[model samples]
Target: MKKPKKPKRPMLAFAVTEIDDHTGGIVWARTKKAARIKGAARWGYDEPAYVTCRREPWADRFHSKPLPVWVMVANGWHFDCLGCGIRIDEDLPNWQDRCGADDTFRDMLREARRYRKWTPQCVIGHQHSDVFCSQDCKDADDAYRAACKRKEAHAISVFQAKVLKRFPGVTLVTDRDRMHPHAYATSRKRGIVVQQVSVEFEFPGMRYGPASLRWDSPFSSSYRKVEKPYFSCCNGDRAAFEAYAAATRRAAQEPTDRDHP
Candidate 1:
């Protein structure tokens, strides 16, 4: 009779419970007790060590596996296939082999292996490889930015409206291109078109003077006249506009008194 063949030794697996400097590792073992013994030898006294087994993948697609395996808990590594919810060895040979379904799977696996992070999601909750989930998300973000710009423009318009309401003779000077809001007032008696006192709404806090404001004008001579003096007010300060109107009226009256004298 042929000599009896010795039974093949079962494949052994060991999970890294702890390593030097709070790292993790894996080892093959002949038995569960032996695996634990090896882990203790490497990690020192009272460190965690375990005998783990590998499991087959549930499905063969990247999209099917939305969550990631290979997690770190208290400086210890844990391995589980998120798709199948099965315990796996640290090397993850079974899971990695199953991920070779398609190019997308390979790419996703590469990213997961490289960064050890899952796919990113947008603020609105769609997941993607990039910042946004799709073109629609990008468009929505763009629309949000545009709405903010329009709101700022509306604020400037509302401020201009308040100024015009307070000073009846003033009109927004559309003919002159400006970085900030600009308006002019025509003196009914003097027939002189002088720029009304307006604040620079662009930045650096609204202040008085034509130099404080910026504008584009083909006829630079038009704005050559000194800006009518008025009490400076903080931007969007309605009470300040009221005071400015009163001061301007007083200034106009004083000039007229001098002229008549």
Candidate 2:
């Protein structure tokens, strides 16, 4: 028989900032130690939300000290993409040249900047701080972390060279640690990529909505057999789109509802 795994404990932590739409400040939990709630801390409005960081199993002489590289969100802060794996193919190398007249990357930044203006002005990247992790990891976790950062940096550089061309006055601002905003915008310039709530949209003359939607594409929808792909922001709008469905079912009686019955 296999041994059963033990349940993990919860840790107590604090939120460093007040996220705009979030009801409470974010929290950081350490060591899997749960904290008890008190009057204000336990109250519905004042309840303290927490996030936890697991302690690395290897605590060696090197582990005792922080790593040389900047700390990833895994250590303390929680940074993630709000719109990942959508139809963001335009940004990829293979599909780059396809979107000419309409570019989705622009739409992404614009949409990201609209409501969450606080993202650029204040949100910080993990690289800005001295918190580093051990380079000793000889596993997949280490490789994944490195790759994610590289992807972000490469994307940012591309934005600086290509996207900012139209807007001449815009310039990029980076810290020594390379930590910026999830998506930062300046007086004239804005960030390259940022996370936001899910978005859905539909263009004219499409039957089924696309899994993901982009505002612009270099490809000509008019020339193609299909006009343009449309998308819904949320999954709840399918009923509104029934008319466009390619398939439908009809109820019938015996012998295909023949009048002879």
Candidate 3:
């Protein structure tokens, strides 16, 4: 019968030792204790300080003793397979070959913490770490958003047409000035401008009732609206509009009592 083969063990490449800050070189020895003693002898001081050195790449420095459990816990260190949550033992020589968990310990810990509460899943039931499972899901989401934008554009165009028919000869100023007024007009006498005019309609969700008309005369910097029942000032009634325009023109032309002799 053939003899059973012994399992191979993993080995660490670097040893922890005190470094000479002046020279930027490691004070190395056969063991950590020996390195410490050598550091004390060279510097004439007894202090426990060490750093990792890779001068001897094949050296098995940390094989004898594993890192302390307390230190590992405090530093939030762990190795686990992301696919199955299986703990990976780095001490085994063939650990990487067995589970393929090659991510650094710190990186694995960060990923675990980030997805602790929820693991993302696609609409089709595929599990993943990203917002969608695959490119197909991402494309579908984009298409849905585009369709919503198109529907909204159609509705706005229909509303704008209605407004144009209702208020002829008025300029439609959207964009930043959407809240200013629905439509605006420039009052002219013999093709020469006299005053600025704007009209606001009473939509379904308006806070106030009836439409409103505003006018900016030479004397005022901003357009002023008449008190409630302002709709009577315009509202496509020729007689009402003529009376309101005449009153405003007279007010602008006449001087106040304060300026009279």
Strongest candidate by lDDT: 1
lDDT of each: 0.39, 0.31, 0.38
Q: Model 1: per-residue lDDT, tens digit, 78-112?
A: 33332233333333333455454565866766545
- The C-alpha stretches of model 2 lying farther than 4 A from their native spots are 1-138, 173-261
Query: TM-score, each model?
Result: 0.24, 0.21, 0.23
RMSD of every prediction: 23.2, 23.6, 25.7
**Candidate 2, residue 25: how far the Cα is off, in Å:** 19
lDDT of 1 at 137: 45
**What lDDT is reached at residue 250 by model 2?**
31
Tens digits of lDDT, candidate 2, 1-261: 989998764433433332333322222334333221221243233442432223433222222243222222323333322123122111222343334566688865544443232222122222223221212222333455565555445544543333223223223334435343122211112322222111222423334542222122223232223223222323554554343332221321111111110
Full ranking by lDDT: 1, 3, 2
Decreasing TM-score order of the candidates: 1, 3, 2
90 Cα displacement, candidate 3 (Å): 22
